[model samples]
Target: MKENVFYGKGMGPVKKDYPDIYEAIVGLNDAVYTGKALDYKTQKLIALAIAASNSDDRAVKKQISSVVETFDTSKDEIMDVLRIVLLTSGMPPFVKAVNLLYEVID
Candidate 1:
């Protein structure tokens, strides 16, 4: 059985089951932070949008926490970014992101 990446609740079997692939992705994420392509605030906003677009609630929550800690962005600004993501990525994903944000921010 695969451990859940999201809530500690049970999830089924792993899909990829490839440790090397996971490591590569982790490495790439670290690489992205090596150069300051964008300011921390902008990156946080982008991460929020991307998580929303991908309908990844865990990532949305994580990114929201990062934004709150790193940039000290207000909740309103985070909501605004989520709204923009909704405008582009549609309602369902936006709703998921909003729910995740609420769970984290609360």
Candidate 2:
């Protein structure tokens, strides 16, 4: 399994220092990412939107990178997600997310 970029550096420390906790987190991720109702790509897009909505620049960039690398997610798909962020989260976060998206993709 690929390391979740959202977890960043903290995950390595947690996994090294607290193996049980890391495994629990990994289990939770496995459960949550199951493609039952929505496919993994859709789930990732939703996650990207959430990251954008929160104005989390690092998360936005990492999510974009991970999604694109893992799923070959297209720019248009990401733009659609960013559209939602624009409506629900306003211009600032949306702009930040768009900028980060370009940084990662282009």
Compare the candidates by TM-score and give the number of the best one: 2
Clashing pairs in 1: none
Per-prediction count of colliding residue pairs? 0, 0
The digit string of per-residue lDDT tens for model 2 on 1-106 reads 3454435668888889999998898888888888889988888889889989999887888889889989888999999999999999899999999999889989
- Estimate every model's Cα lDDT from 0 to 1: 0.72, 0.87
Candidate 2, residue 9: how far the Cα is off, in Å: 2.0
Instruction: Give the range where candidate 2 is weakest over 10 consecutive residues by summed lDDT.
Output: 1-10
**In terms of lDDT, which candidate is strongest?**
2
Q: By summed lDDT, which 10 consecutive residues of candidate 1 come out lowest?
A: 1-10
Instruction: Report the C-alpha lDDT of model 1 over 1-106, residue by residue, as the tens digit.
Output: 1111333122222224756656565566566554377765786588679988999777788788877876677879999998898899999998898888888778
